[model samples]
Target: MKLRTVLGAALAAGLGWLLFAPTRVRPVAWEGPGLPPSRTSGPYADNGRLNTAELLAPVPGLKAPESVAVDAQGRLYSGFEGGAVVRFQPDGTAPEVFADTGGRPLGLRFHPDGNLLIADALRGLLRVGPEGSVQVLATGAEGVPFRFTDDLDVDRAGRFVYFTDASSRYGWPHELLDLLEHGGHGRVLRHDLHTGETVVLARGLNFPNGVTLGPDEAYLLVTETGTARVHRLWLAGERAGTLEVFADSLPGYPDNVRFDGAGTFWVALPSRRSPLLDAGARQPWLRRVIARIAERAHLPLPEESMLVALDLKGRPVAFAQGSGSASYSYITQVLPVGDALILSSLHGQTLARVPLAQVRP
Candidate 1:
């Protein structure tokens, strides 16, 4: 009789725990002031409007175009989540495979010596030689292996390469957890091929992704994807070796950043900022629970799609955005080619280029 009574009590307790235990869906209440708003004018100033007719729809079998780079011969290069570096020629020809990275390639840049520097999410930093040979430049930092190597930028000298490690916990497939945790796992690092040295230029970043060198090479700008801010690290002059916020209060989560010769910086916002993410940052415990539950369920959180252009002073010069409902979903990177802006997507099959002249300033 005692054994029966104990078993009943135990079952009751178990049922009670299942019914009343804290789930991962509680409301968040964070209230800190967000970063400053963007200072530049948007494309609306110039009367820009998206011309859907000009956009090139995806080829029959492409997938998840992430980052883009251009060569001197006017050839466009794009890295894909499917591990292919595809090239598009200026003559409106079909894109051909430049190389198969065998890992998610997020960022691509043409080195002065004709090699391609790739920030591969799964394979770490790689240098693709002119002959298409692959070499790993970096795999870890400070004895800790990289969980996500997101983007890269090569200096004019070609001796220095700067890149971002988006997170230490999540690679591309489960990036939503990084947003939920909001623990500042991102970092920016510089690799010097001439000296065979690697240095952490900045740390404690919030999902740092795209990187670009400023006009004078005086500083390098990095985008903090989770926080919607761009940070600058001075490489020369009085501010040498120091970091400062270049721009903030972005309309959405900033991804890959690129600088054009015409004094504009292009940024890709994969998704709009989620109110839930803002709320979760205030309640660490809630975030922790969400992370734990997310691990168990293998569910992905939501993200938005958009693109914006900013000048050197970190002000918005133009805004080109599309929601998930639109054809452009999860736009990850933008490259300004002549008067057109080349757009890359994280969840779409094709690459797109919109004419800047067609859009207002």
Candidate 2:
């Protein structure tokens, strides 16, 4: 090839990239906090050792099940992308439509009064009783409506419900975009059933994913996905009305946090961060370009089926990993019932029911 012709082609390609590719995403600048080390050894050395083949309770016609609620009768319940809350048998078979939420549901918790409460991303909070009737709970706090209600937990006495609004700038569809922007529009809210009031506990959270009360119900644990940290909001104590980091430097961005009755806090990590994402955190333009490319390529997701079990004091205790031979990924929550840890996935068709005995060392 002639040198002049080669030079002309290169110039034209560069010109095209500068014009078309740069504006594809047009993302705003967001310098995210430097990510922690990829691996933490102390209590997580046994990560990714769980046997995925043993779990996997099948459900027919369920799509993108992400949250689970085990009723008093051992009935398993989950929310699907199609705005339906389903009830399943103990072994995770036999599907029934417990209630049609008519909006995307993301979190499930059973009230002490036998009511199934839900954090619907599009419809705010909801309550479904055994009669199969659905009622709207709290939709907004501080005079503003909830934009992305993510997860919730009822207090031990069922007096209050703590929940998270993942992002006020993004709805259910633009979660990744919100992450890319590093928007701190997330918040933790409390709904008092007695007072019939919804109030904001804390604001400016970075993609807060889940909310659960502390062991004694004196404080709340909130997962900040963009920061890969968990925070505690004290309600009654020396630290009451104060917020502090409960767990920091997580292995990956956390999604949901749950407290098992037996003193374990089960946390779900949807996926491990990539070097590309880290670089994008520094270069906003690069993140936009990467997002466009990923959407177009139908990329194969990097799976890290990682779940961390934290002690009641917010210390790491156990790590349940299923990286090997696990077809399911993007775990959103893990509820410990007896000796089993029921894992819900954001894009999986079946729920995982790994034995706690197998998850621990």
Q: Could you tell me every candidate's TM-score relative to the true structure?
A: 0.85, 0.88
Total backbone collisions, model 2: 0
Tens-digit per-residue lDDT, 1-361, candidate 2 = 6999999999998766654663334455655546555464656553555546344556667778888889999998999988888888887777778888999999999999999999999999899989878889888887778889999999879999989989887788567666666757899988898888988889988889988877679888899987778898898968788899888877778988888767878899878765666666767766666566654564443557778888877888887666655535788888888878888888788677777877775
Whole-model Cα lDDT of every candidate shown, in order: 0.76, 0.80
Model 2, residue pairs in steric clash: none
**Candidate 1 lDDT, 1-361, residue by residue in tens:** 9999999999998766544556443333444227434324543221214424144544556688888888889888887767888888874357788888889898899999889999999998999876667899998888767889999998888999999889876777667677676667788899998886778888877788899998889999899877778888898999898999888777678889998867888888777666566666677666666666675677543555467788888887677654324446577887877777777887767687666764335
In terms of TM-score, which candidate is strongest? 2
- Model 2 lDDT at residue 95: 76
- Assess the local accuracy of residue 247 in candidate 1 as a C-alpha lDDT between 0 and 100: 81
Off by over 4 Å in 2: 1-42, 53-57, 291-301
Q: How far is each candidate from the true structure, as Cα RMSD in Å? A: 5.4, 3.1
